[model samples]
Target: MSDVQVRGARLEDEAAIREIADQEMAAQEALDPRFGFRPDASGRYSVYLRERIRDLDSVVFVAEVGGAVVGVAIGTIRKQESLFELRRFGYISDLMVKPAARRLGVGRALYDRLLTWFRGLGVRVARMHVAARSDEARAFWKSVGAEPWLTESWVDVPAADGPPDPAGSEAKPAPKRAAGGYAGDLPDDDPSPAGMADASDDDTDTDDDTDTDAGDEATAGEPTSTRGADE
Candidate 1:
């Protein structure tokens, strides 16, 4: 391999970085089915990198060999708020090196440059998330003195009977509709006369009747209110 140079990324390096990212993503997904590496059909990854390059808190670095980029690292400085303290930390969002560049110290060079940038920003704590099945990534992190603190898990739910919705698993309960057809618990001033009457009657009945009657009414109206809020 030619001399490897690691430095901050620039706009002209966009294409090279994107290609390396795609290559690494494909290789990771091949290694672990749970990676769920979706191809960037819309060029969103490049756009994201471009945006990050211009962000004050973000740092992007690339490693070049023989005048060609072979590795990349993207990171950011984040303000972390906790019960006991507020502090700034560095987050490694991505780190990738070409297959031919592995075991050649390219990844280490990129990480060291990123760490330097973080230190310049006065950040002491750095963190990154690695896939459980990615042994290579875990080993690299450990080599850099990083320790795991959390584990993440995912579940894939199939569509019941129609086309798959990308957000199906995150579907929320529908909001309840008010008597006035309003979706939320909005102010009563805008309610229709009939809705107001119904609300008033319900309130009065709840105050005067058995608790069972109030519970039943609440159960009957719950769905409508939920659906309304969702809308």
Candidate 2:
């Protein structure tokens, strides 16, 4: 077994951190059509990842192979409803490792460290999302006791019928649903509104959470792209 280390990510690790997120997004996009995450041309994803690194309520774990980050597990210590009040749930935003690094415990080690971090924060539950059809990822989560807490679905509202004006076509989104899974569970009531999770994660838990598959097998390794559930 190789000597791998796991610890909190530093801001200086932004470039390497973003690279892992980007690569993981690429893998997810290839499998999950609903969660198709696409990176901008900037090759810089810290606009989305920076806050996690600095969050007192969040944890970002990095696994280094030969001193370079090869896997990541970024999550928040959230107070998800129905679970508990002041719940310290580790909502794993992303987890990825290079194909060459697969099955080397890089991921398992990272998970162990972050899990310890969450437990230290007094977290009652932990959450993560997986593609609906990724065998490798499903097995990985299963092996680590990460259950499928929710089932996710999505829709495609065709753009308005009109001339496809270059740099002019806009995709009008649907209104909010009060009982939806992801989109339904947002804490808009909080003074700190997160602007209703980015359009990318149409699967937000804005209201209530229903994770029927919480501990079920996660086959999120399909060959397609997917956006976030909501916020």
Candidate 3:
């Protein structure tokens, strides 16, 4: 890792970042069809990376070895709900390192740099999501002191014929879990109300209802593409 260089992502790094993201999305899509990326996802994500690179509230870090980009980590500051004690936190949007770079410090290097940026902004906590089925991802995050919580559930849109009967597609609950579903509070009659999903039975993590200890490290989100297997 002594040779690994972690720095802020540059506009020129967009192609490299998108390449990694493409691979990540493709892998996740194979794990579950719901994780599919749009055919034009690469172009759209490039636009997003450009915006994030220039946005004061966001940070994108890239890791390089011998002048080659090997990894990337992206994050943004988010306002917590008015009901929460903490007002703002850093949300890790994506973490990816090429498969060949696994087990190196690249992922952690990118993560730590992004984390420093968050702390500089006075962000008190950091959060992200890992697919429930990605044992390697979960293990990598846990190795870095992230605790797992909340199962994010997804259901196909019920036919719009009636009041939206979701019972047919409801996901089974993970054992012993109490909280976590979609993040927002939708009305009871809301057609798109989210339901709890068990990680044991789920592949993607989308949204969750969570309570964090100040400055804790963690994981939760939609399926992450290529997390470094630093464990």
Candidate 4:
């Protein structure tokens, strides 16, 4: 095992984190065309990380080996609907470890730090989204005691034409649902460039330790890109 040190993220770490995030995003996009980056994603992600580092309800952690950061994890507190049994839950937004650092415990160290912070905030259950097609991701989460809480479905919505089919004059057929799962869930801040409607993620968490898969698997051999639900 490699000697890994985990600590809270500082402002100076934004560039490194963004670089890893970019690589992860590109890799996941390759897995599923639906995953994409926004205009100036680097700058935008840097800004987003900076804000997360300072936010009281959010936490960012970094894992270092030989004095260089090789892994990162991000999480935030979320309020559930009043009707839910748990009033608030912990949402992992991003988790990543460099490819070279896989299996060295770097990702797990970073994750443990985030969990510590979440527990400090009184969060009882931690939740996240994983890429649907990544067998690696699913296996990793299973090793860590996280089961599939739900499956998210996706579909394409075609543009409407001619005033809703003239109020029932030959009603149009329903749009076809898109096949396959998401590349992964996107970070809240990493939306497509302006003028593009946000593609809402069916899953809720993001992680990328394996690079393409998100969720707990990112902590082992993978790194979730975007929110790939690994966060």
lDDT of 1 by residue, 1-231 (tens): 356698889999999977765655555456455545345421766777788799998878878878889777676666643432635556555666666666666666666677778778786665544544444554455444454443344666666675667776856787865343311122233111101000000111001000111111110011000000000
Clash counts for the predictions, in order: 14, 49, 4, 27
Per-residue CA lDDT of candidate 4, range 1-231, in tens? Answer: 568898888998888877777766665566567655555776776777788789988778877889988767777666654555766666666666665666666655665676677767777666666555544444445444455554556776556652454456665686653332123233344432211110011112222221221243222122344322122
Measured on C-alpha atoms, candidate 1 has an lDDT of: 0.48
- Give the Å shift of residue 58 in candidate 3: 0.3
Instruction: Choose 1 or 3, whichever is better by TM-score.
Output: 3
Provide the TM-score for each candidate, comma-separated: 0.65, 0.66, 0.74, 0.72
lDDT-sorted candidate list, best first: 3, 4, 1, 2
Best by lDDT: 3
> By the lDDT metric, which is better: model 1 or model 4?
4
lDDT of 3 at 1: 41
Better of 1 and 4 by TM-score: 4
Lowest lDDT block of 10, candidate 2: 218-227
Stretches off by above 4 angstroms in model 1 are 39-42, 82-86, 156-231
Per-residue lDDT, model 2, residue 59, is 68
- Candidate 2 vs candidate 3: the TM-score winner is 3
Better of 2 and 4 by TM-score: 4
Error of 2 at 145 (Å): 1.7
Error of 1 at 37 (Å): 3.6
Measured with C-alpha atoms, the lDDT of residue 179 in candidate 2 is 35
